[model samples]
Target: MMYISELMTGAPTNERCPLERRMYETLDKLKIPYERVDNDPAASMEECAEVDKVLGTEIRKNVFLCNQKKTTFFLLVMPANKSFDTAAFSKKLGVSHMSFAPPEKMLKHLGTTPGSASVAGLLVDEDDYVQVIVDKEVAESEWFGCNPGINTSHLKFKTQDLLQKFLPKIHHRARIVDL
Candidate 1:
């Protein structure tokens, strides 16, 4: 795990990643204040839970999914403790055969690795290729947390600001579902 301090010699500033730096720059432009914490590269929901502890806020589970043809992509955000039922999700979304999007697809579309997927990544999605769905339980919370384009750094911000302010700028509409 790499700490935010290690990545920054002083205060944070806008920076570009290998692919696109839109995510970092977007937050700066929006002036959304946040705090970052470093943690291990969490591979599963349980591992992410451990990382959440260090951030002092529960990180929502951001799942990258696709349809059978891999044409349509979706970003489902839910509480870390919530379970994902494919059947229920498929029915809710009115899609046939929804599965996890491949790592290559994630990188190509969102410029993020598997364990580092965050709604913040939407800044780079110029095509609007993915639909953002946030669990109702998560949306109702006061604070939301996620990675800042890196697994080692987690960011905390106001849920209202993320949904009401940041999301609108990215042209993202979050569907609050039961799952």
Candidate 2:
């Protein structure tokens, strides 16, 4: 069984991976408050349900995608139950083609591997290359939760802090879509 700890406010006192540390650094620098929980990789939605109970909020699914040529990349954050439709997303975003990007790209661009992509990951995107996409429903939510560049750790914060504060500081604006 996965170990889901009770909700703990703020960043962890213990040491963290450089990537995870960098994520917290960014959040702290932005003066954005957050709550976090450490999990066992959180490999499945069922496992995440336990984590969600501790955070008392929905933890969205994050997908890393790329166009047919791999020239354009996207980091999509949407509700966990929302099934991804490549064609539908492309149509709504007015893109020619889109597909799941390889894990290598996730590492190269976001500095994290599979199962961990979030606004926090975008900090390593020095050139601001990847397109950040958030579903309208998710953007409308009051709270946001995702991994801090490490699947083992998940965090909750104000969605407004993500959209209005943290993201803008990184020069990233989410492409808000209904899908």
- Top TM-score prediction, candidate number: 2
Tens-digit lDDT string for candidate 1 (3-121): 23322212245543543345556666788776665555666667667666666689888989999999999999989888899879999999999999999999888788888888867
Please, what is the TM-score per model?
Answer: 0.86, 0.96
lDDT (CA) for every model shown? 0.77, 0.88
Assess the local accuracy of residue 20 in candidate 1 as a C-alpha lDDT between 0 and 100.
30
Q: Put down candidate 2 lDDT per residue, 123-176, tens digits, no spaces.
A: 889898899999999999999988898889998999999999988999899989
TM-score of 1: 0.86
- Provide the lowest-lDDT 10-residue window in model 1: 2-11
Judging by lDDT against the true structure, name the best candidate. Answer: 2
Q: Any idea what lDDT model 2 has?
A: 0.88
